[model samples]
Target: MQNLARAVLVLFGLLVLAVACIAVSIEGSEPSVPLTEEDVIGTWQGDRGARLEVTADGRARLSDASGWRCFKDGQAGVFTGEGSWIMAQHSDEGPGILVKFTVDGAPATQCSDHFAIHRADTRDGGDVWARWLGTGSKEPYRRTPTG
Candidate 1:
């Protein structure tokens, strides 16, 4: 009886040690690399044909075909109904560019949908855009007109 109890205790200890080792290993693992602007520079088509694209030379072009516009890093342009944007930084959230339009024309931060844009719909849209490729998710973004 004594040996059986000791065996069980030993087994429990080993299990606990193994679990702790695994937890530590997981915790020590490196964080995932943040997506960059270059990774998100391409035409992105949404469910409703909402297309967005970031060019290689640091230009963001978005439009609904009938209506299209572009902007540069320090540049700003009209968005949806009453919105505009000013390109910003490229952070871990993804290649981010500042948006200045409606919502008060305040600086709106937009990250590349490729990294962690959340919503599956958004991700799908991003996939269509394909900006998350070549770019390292750390490249600068500038809004520039297509024409």
Candidate 2:
């Protein structure tokens, strides 16, 4: 009975350590600098055929030629949405933005609602990168060239 109890305690300790490691990995690093509307305003295209158009007036439009994996509410195929956005500092993730919008003219889904964009590159025709709020994976976006 004592051996069984010791094994259970060891398992619990391993579980706790695993959770702590996950938490640390998910936390975002400090931003090099604050992000502004002007910095984000423009047409950004993702590698996955996703496009984001942020306007100076706090308006945003999102379109995905191929349905986004993040939207798992049976929302697939060409999707378009319009919504408002704002830049804010996350307690654990440094700087980020919260975008509230509906998909397919339906009520907004919970997924892909927030993004933590890092200001790592200079704002002049440089690549801007962002990631989902709770995940460490990043997606790179480039500004569409204008005439």
Candidate 3:
């Protein structure tokens, strides 16, 4: 009976050690790098064939031939907006880019204009991922080739 109890205690100790190692590994990971205009000035494709275009002058356009269902106000199709993007430190997720824009000629309440973009470590060949801040919808976007 004593030997069995000792074995159980040793197993519990090993489990605790494993958990600690995983925690340390996650905490020691490096943060994401900041993005610049060169990094984001291009077309990005989202889920359901949606497209977002960012221009060098800080202008942006969101277009979907079907619709942007996330908009609660039922305004869909195309939207023209302008805003600047910046690389900032996220409190929990390390470095990320914040995109702030407003739909042109739409009510302020109809649009949730903030988004977060982060570099996806799992991707190669200049692919990044983004999420809408209000609806929590995520999508992967690849840079469109430019000449």
What TM-score would each prediction reach against the true structure?
0.32, 0.58, 0.55
Candidate 3 colliding pairs? none
lDDT, each prediction = 0.40, 0.65, 0.59
The residue-by-residue lDDT of candidate 3 on 1-147, one tens digit each, is 999999999999999999999999876654345556676778877765667787777666665524443344665444445456555546665444565655566546334334456664533554466655443244445556788
Which model, 2 or 3, shows the larger lDDT? Answer: 2
Backbone clashes under 3 angstroms, per model: 24, 0, 0
Give candidate 1 regions above 4 Å deviation: 1-31, 65-147
Tens digits of per-residue lDDT, candidate 2, 44-134, equal 7877777888888888787763544435555445656777888876777667677766666566453445666665455454455765454
Ranking, lDDT, top scorer first: 2, 3, 1
- The TM-score of predicted model 1 comes to 0.32
Evaluate model 2: give its lDDT. 0.65
At residue 86, what lDDT does model 1 achieve?
36
What are the runs in model 3 whose C-alpha is more than 4 Å off?
Answer: 1-24, 27-31, 65-82, 92-94, 107-112, 122-127
Best model per TM-score: 2
lDDT string for model 1 (35-133, tens) is 455445454554444455545665454444222222235343333322233344435543344422222233453422231222213334322122222
